[model samples]
Target: MSFEHVFKRIIEFMHADPCGNFRLMVGTDSQVHKRHTVFITGIVIQNEGKGVWACIKKVVVPRKMTQLHERISLELSLTEEIVGLFTEERKNELIEIVLPNLYKGATFTMEGHIDIGAGKRNKTSEFVKEMVTRMESMGVEPKIKPNAFVASSYANRYTK
Candidate 1:
């Protein structure tokens, strides 16, 4: 579906009084093959009591992402590219219309869920802090690991 259409659907879902409350999340994940790679970007709206609503799109990169940092960068870049479709004015309109109190003093755009996280055996842990820092600098809120289901779960599924 078109990005604008998908975005509108998300806004509509948000305004539908979804079991009282909901959080909007977006992210990307990738699966590498010997000669190519597939990336999946997803948007997930988690309602307080009603079930979840989601959408996804997949694209292929000609080259494999063999390096950890390279993979992380591609995931982050793809997600950012998708999110770029959501203009600031429109996002604020949704916040004003449906999620006024939810974000309080925050910027209130879709939360980005990065696949990187902290842990001993998790190599992606090394990029967690750096990725969070960069995303914050760009005025975005980022989540990872257990809280990053939009990327680690939703996006990862279609990447396979």
Candidate 2:
């Protein structure tokens, strides 16, 4: 099936609101290879920390990345695609279903988990601030390090 179909399925699941509380999470993780880099993005529908429904997309670059800016640019593009998958109309409908009194519309919380963290001495640390800002600017909440399970754990699984 196409990504659009998959996203719509998830959105329908959200509209059902069966689990009482649900959280939608989006995150990306990448691994460097000798000649190329493997990038994976994970979208998760979490059920109040009890369980989750997840999907992932992967892409492999043709060459190794040497610059932080270049790597971040690629991440940005992939992140945008994931965020853009949900249309405002569809999202509002789902939210309205969950919150009937939401005449002004509904608000759903999405956290974009970045694979980079400041707690470690890694290349990603230098880019933490930039990534946090990038995520905020895109209207998605940002998470990093141990708190970023969807990216660091869920998406990281597909990178291998």
Strongest candidate by TM-score: 1
lDDT against the true structure, per candidate, is 0.78, 0.75
Span of 10 residues, lowest total lDDT, candidate 2:
100-109
Q: What is the TM-score of each candidate against the true structure?
A: 0.87, 0.83
How would you encode candidate 2's per-residue C-alpha lDDT over 1-160 as one tens digit per residue? 5877777777676665543466778887777788999889888876564566788888899888877767766766687688776668656655555575344333456788877778666767878888899888877788888898888898888887
Best by lDDT: 1
Q: Candidate 1, residues 1-160: lDDT per residue as tens digits?
A: 8877887887787667622465777798999998999989898876656767899988898987799899898888887876666678767766775555554432234688898879879989888888887667656688988889999988998887
Global CA lDDT computed for model 1: 0.78
After best superposition, candidate 1 residue 62: deviation in angstroms? 1.4
Give me the runs in candidate 1 sitting further than 4 Å from their true place.
Answer: 99-109
